[model samples]
Target: MSASPGAYRAPGAGLRALQLLGIVWTLPNTLVGCVLGVAGLAAGAHMHLRVRDLAIVFHRWPWGPGGALTLGNVILHTGDTLDSACMTYAHRAGHGEEAPIVLADHERAHVYQYMVLGPLFLPLYLLCGGVSVRNRFERAADRYACEGRSWWPW
Candidate 1:
């Protein structure tokens, strides 16, 4: 079957690993989630992913207002949501919710890294401390954005 546009597909190979890890790691904790889940995102993702109601996934990270990782998106804690934007409008700006501005620009840099660095970026990017990673990637994206590539809309 053909894929839809930006429907969020995880490549088959990646999906299998994610599923295996989820079953192994999450099955134990499922019961307690009957209580108010720490983050509704976890329950929601698990449900959608479990039944194949959604596409496969591999990585997801959340950014704080000042750019910090949300425990919900970290694999060791909440498992990966795989490219989730887990964004918020908490910090209203002149243009309103800055989450889109932050997330889109950030992820676009990731794409740019893939283009320029050609696969080495993720590994090297992960080596840095969390704060460094956030700053560096965002800056890389911003630099790319400033280049007037005319590819990214904004």
Candidate 2:
């Protein structure tokens, strides 16, 4: 059968192993995402939960987790979601059907970022620029997700 527009396949064992390591290393910031979940609840955002591959995902959040946390070194939004240290929280996107797959790949790349950058990802991500599609981190993540397919809209 043909795959849907945004269909995705899970990463292999080696990548999953690295993602596990990243999850452990980035726990401090992941806790921040938990807090935001509470905040989102208080603000009346309904969180839809799921486990996809390595990250726990929260979808359909009302208020955003924010672009970046100043002191926490936490990133709360990527594309239409927040790719935390261990979990990815997202809201519904008005974009096309391919959005989920695209965002998932990009966020998976962020998990790798946690592995590579450890405590420095935030500073460097901001130094390059924030979460714009043009930012180095975002661009790199996009590239990582696409696996050099070179067919992205951003």
Candidate 3:
């Protein structure tokens, strides 16, 4: 899952900060699979209504073997944060437009969203309780990025 355009921070609680290189959310992660789920939520992490409102705060990659942290993070939820805290996926090539640029687009959007709507509408674009990972919001982001940019990974 790579970062797309329409994805926004989800609402929930206790955001878990994650790293893409070492903490890859993958299969073979069974009963011992971090319990609460994989890579999204971590200890001492909580969504700040203020922070989440100000930023999408995506932290978890919640998808596939080689999860796109930048793309995937936008769809993750922890109470109110989109993710514990935004982090990039490990595979640079998978990131499509070079990791840094991909990250810049994805993370910068959080800032833009904050400025445009003041984080009040974060959940309006998110899929809560009713769905799991890779729901409407993520799909929307994919659709958005699929515009003219061939570099985006759906």
Which pairs clash inside model 2? none
Preferred candidate (TM-score higher): 1 or 3: 1
The 10-residue segment of model 1 with minimum total lDDT is: 68-77
Instruction: State the lDDT of candidate 1 residue by residue for 1-154, as single tens digits.
Output: 6432223355487866765554444332332332223244453433232222211122222222333221111221134432334333222323334333333333433443433343344455566433442445544543433342332212
Question: Which scores greater on lDDT, model 1 or model 2?
Answer: 2
If scored against the real structure, what TM-score would every candidate get? 0.29, 0.57, 0.24
Q: What lDDT score belongs to each candidate, Candidate 1 first? A: 0.35, 0.50, 0.32
Per-residue CA lDDT of model 2 for 44-78, tens digit only, reads 54444434524444444455453323212233332
- The numbered model that scores best in lDDT is 2
Model 2 gets an lDDT of: 0.50
lDDT of 3 by residue, 1-154 (tens): 7534434466344433322211233212212223333344454333222233232233333444433222222323333333232323322325434222223334334333323333332454353312222333333333333331322211
What alpha-carbon RMSD in Å does predicted model 1 have with respect to the real structure?
Answer: 10.8
* C-alpha RMSD values across all candidates: 10.8, 7.8, 14.3
Is candidate 1 or 2 superior in TM-score? 2
The regions of model 1 sitting more than 4 angstroms off are 1-42, 46-102, 115-119, 127-129, 133-135, 144-154
Q: Cα deviation of 102 in candidate 1 (Å)?
A: 4.5
